[model samples]
Target: MRNNGSDVLLTAIAPIVWGSTYIVTTQFLPDFSPISVAMLRALPAGLLLLLIVRQLPRGIWWLRTFVLGALNISIFLSMLFVAAYRLPGGVAGTVAAVQPLFAVFLARLLLSSPIRPLSIVAALVGIAGVALLVLTPRAALDPIGIAAGLAGAASMAVGNILTRKWQPPVSLLTFTAWQLTAGGVLLVPVVLAFAPHLPAPTAVNLAGLAWLGLIGAALTYVLWFRGIAKLDSSVVSPLLFISPLTAVILGWTFLGQTLSPIQLAGVGFVIGSIWLSQRPAR
Candidate 1:
């Protein structure tokens, strides 16, 4: 293993960059179909990475790759869009925040990682902070949206654990490429059947797609999978707290969204929880 500090820092960048997705999607791709955007975001990046690696799955890896793809990318992204469109952003985000806790338990069940009390504490704090940061008293919840959020969180949690458990005999880049490509491929029919034809993209829309495909999907997932392989799932799961934190900050900074005192306090909680989760258990 290399420097734990460096691994954490590098892995953390993926989610931080992901925080910009909401901002970019709204400002540039607002009129785009969510499923189509997801497909575009995934497929191009997957193909680009495949081109670089020039590798394909073999034997059982074929099934494993697709399963991971469905859990991690295709289903997760689909549920994310469904929740975001059907429910308030805060409700969706907070509900999905359960992912860390789910990861902890899933790791214990699947990977036999220790279930430390500190891990539970950190996960709880992280969830509370996200709720504070995003949830609104007036936010209306739809049953389907709530279900999607929960399912998405569980899907991602299982995917994270499975990635940690599988340890594919390939470089992180190849592993990432396989999952992304598989996921994008799975979404082809969904987009074709459900989504209408997209209008010709302007320069800004193309730029947004480029950033999401190149940076958000390809680069970020590479970092994320690297983290999953190197770090304990408990350690890596809490890092996702940074995504919502970054989102809130971006909203305030770029979108001129007002941050309440509660949200600021939630920010503190999130930072503290992250730091706490990374601490080695005594």
Candidate 2:
């Protein structure tokens, strides 16, 4: 078994890598349709993992994998992309910050987990920090985008909870492979029907897609699923704050973006929230 601190940090790699997705999507794969992008990102990585594992879901697993895939990958990515396309990045991010908060209640309903007051407060602080970290005063929201963002967050929260509830009798690698492949398969028809018209991908586009598929989806998800299995869902959920924190830092480092005082304060809040969430229940 992995140590607690190491597991958390390792799982955190998933979101930290994810923080780069925004930059990659905008800079390198700007022209692809969101649905097609989602499909390509998930399917290829999933296939590669499947090849490595050399196993397939059987019996009830087929259903479970598909359901989990829809919740975790297909629906979540599609809605997230819709929100990204429709709303300012800041607006989309702030709206999605509700995820950890939503997970608390959902866990109560589904897993019968305690409604820890501190956890709630931590989630609120995390939301505020995300707003400060990512939201701009000029952020504009579309109703559809706001709804899609919430749906994406909700999808992910439920997926996290269900992943905890339903422990597969398989390795984390196998489980991750099942979900990703299933999710990618579900997106097949959607991509065919609704994928936006775009020009052919250049070599740069292929490189970006390869990064997203291999590193962003395949490697990160193994860590994520393992974390969900080992840690409390509440603990893992709050770690999502790391994604935004990493995003802001990347912006400063690579994009020549400057961090204001408020954003720095937001970083404090995000860190504090993660700490509070990980603390043992009083």
Candidate 3:
């Protein structure tokens, strides 16, 4: 088993890479088709990973992968995008930040991990920090969007809990491919039904797709599941705070955005909560 420190660091990379997605979407990707972008990110990355791994899942794992893929990729992405379209990004993001809390609950119910008080408190603190960091004064809540966001978080939380509970029998790469391919395959109809069409294959579009597929989906997920297999779900979940924090840093560095005093405090809360959550359990 990997040490906690190494596992934490490895898990951290997934969210940090995820943080870059916002800027990449805005600056590089073609406009206005979230479904296509999601589909392209998942499917191609999955195919590449499958090719690299060159292993198929065993019988029960086939079913498990389908279930996991649906929750983690297809449903989560679909609901997340629906929420994003209907609500302010901040609102949707804040709702999504509740995922760690959901993971806490699911971990308790599914994995039989005793609930830690500190972990719960840390999750709340992290959610508040995400809110302060992303929620705008002008933000308004739409019921549909709120529901979608909560649903997305719930789906992802269950997926994480299940992943921790059911350590795959295959190698990490093969396991990753299983989930990705299943999810990607499930997304086909959704993409066909919803997306107007695939984004034009311009140079920038291709680059954007490549980055999202290769780095964001394939590589990042491999790192994520490795952490999941090695660490508790709660331990892996709190690292998600890194996503927003990384996004803030990236925006400040690249987009010339400045953080307000409140936002800086939010950053502190996020970092502190991560530390508190990861501390040795009493």
**C-alpha RMSD in Å of predicted model 3 compared with the true structure:** 2.0
TM-score versus the correct structure, for each prediction? 0.95, 0.95, 0.93
What is the C-alpha lDDT profile of model 2 across 1-282, one tens digit per residue? 223898888988988887777677777887887788788889989988999999988898889899999999999888877776777555677777899999999999999999999989999999999888877666676899899989999999999999999899899999989898989999999887777465688999999999889998999999999999998888889888787677678778878887889988999999999989888876
Q: Tens digit of lDDT per residue, candidate 3, span 1-282?
A: 234797799889998987777677767863747667767788888888899988888888889999999998888867766765676544566778889999887888987889999989999999999888867576688898889889988998999888877888888888888888888899888777878566558888788779888998899999999988888777888998887777777878888877889888899999988988887776
- Candidate 2 versus the native: TM-score? 0.95
lDDT, model 1: 0.87
Candidate 3 similarity to native, TM-score: 0.93
Q: Write the per-residue lDDT of candidate 1 for residues 1-282, one digit (tens) a residue.
A: 232999999999988987777677777887788788888888899999999999999999999999999999998877876776676555677778899999888888897887899999999999999888988676788999889989988999999899888889999999989999999999999988988688799999999999989999999999999999888888898998888788778878877878889998998899899998998867
Task: Return the lDDT, model 1, position 276.
Answer: 89
The 0-to-1 C-alpha lDDT of every candidate, in the order given, reads: 0.87, 0.86, 0.82
lDDT of model number 2: 0.86
Query: What is the full ranking by TM-score, best candidate first?
Result: 2, 1, 3
Clash list (residue pairs), candidate 3 = none
Query: Lowest-lDDT window of 10 residues in candidate 2?
Result: 84-93
